[model samples]
Target: MNDELSLPATELVRRTLAHAKRLLPAALFHHSVRTYLYGRLLGEQRGLRPGRDYDDELLFLGCVLHDCGLSAEGDGDQRFELDGADLAVRFLEGEGVASDRAQVVWDAIALHMDREIAERKRPEIALVALGAGFDLGGGPERLPPGYTDRVHRVLPRLHAAAVLHDSIVRQALENPRKAPPFTMQGELVRQATGGSWPTWEHLARSAGWNDYEGYRP
Candidate 1:
């Protein structure tokens, strides 16, 4: 734990964990923690260093709080991503985080769902998206040797996909405004409610990477 993850042990970290654990569901809570772990791996793989390139604590905060909108406390009228971003920003501000840093985390949460822009941003922002996506989509083989088992051994994924999907779908069902077309929640609701919508994957392939089907990093 000390060498592999080296998770920050600040008071802020403690408060952040407590806040998230109280609000987020079991699956999401686990997924949030794993997001930090995966984000760390992604950062290392991309030659980014903690403290110098980005604050590890901020990265941890962003990853853990990224899905806050799914929680009842963070619920708001905007897209879950934006609502979650606002929730996190408020929390960070209350905890005395610098304004600029809070904005970065806001961007991290706001863009976590974006497959297009997040990867091109700074490490703190990019890692949250890349790591979250990697956790939810990519297989263990995509990571370095033994990394997946190590991460899972610490925090097992508890039906994350179904739990997360159901949570988002349920919210969108209750509040149609929460699911605007083209957003992740909206598309998910479309698929869940049996409505017609072009999937992101279909669009991505049409946009060109179709020839790189089996390509691996």
Candidate 2:
């Protein structure tokens, strides 16, 4: 499925990936790729067609760059989602992408954490949150049969839930702005600091995957 809907990487996608690789961790980067794959699958499930309902390249960019805030280059005195969005937009500017397209990716990354709001937006934005939710144990029965095993065989999960959750908690601890109250990062930070949230560790233990080896406690 590396064909990405039977299309090769456009120049923009190539540039986006190159930039993202410089910022994202290996595990997170792979998660980003899987996000695109899963998002595409979910779109197809909902009868949405790429290049018609939305731009496929934009979807790819949004999914891959959605976590840039977790990277040092993208870190800032703001929520990770916002920071990540800003960083992605800036990178897009460097690639000479139009402002409107860049804004789509911005909204996708920034709102991917908000199910209610994101689901109300355009597919370009909404699909991102849905896909991320799916990857994190939502709608497991809805995914196509054997899809997880197939994609994961090519690109390992690397315990993405555990990795992503802990990264947010750690960064939020170091810089409080990154985990402002009411956000997921704030909840994760609280969890790591003896408070509790229904965290990825909880999800992983309950997921029955029996393959979680990241982030203890």
Candidate 1 Cα errors over 4 Å, as ranges: 139-141, 197-217
User: What ranges in model 2 sit over 4 Å off?
Assistant: 1-8, 195-217
- Residue-wise C-alpha lDDT for candidate 2, range 1-217, written one tens digit per residue: 5553332269988878878878887788878877888888898989999988889899999998999999998888999889999999999998899999999999999999997999999998988888888877768437767877887887788888889998898788889888865577887887678765566667778888875766465
User: What C-alpha lDDT do the candidate models reach, one value each?
Assistant: 0.87, 0.84
Candidate 1, 169-192: lDDT as tens digits = 998899989998787788899988
Using all chains and alpha carbons, the TM-scores for the candidates as numbered come to 0.86, 0.85
Q: Which pairs clash (backbone N, Cα, C closer than 3 Å) in model 1?
A: none
Stretch of 10 with least lDDT, candidate 2: 1-10
**TM-score of structure candidate 1:** 0.86
lDDT (C-alpha) at residue 177 in model 1: 95
lDDT of 2 at 190: 77
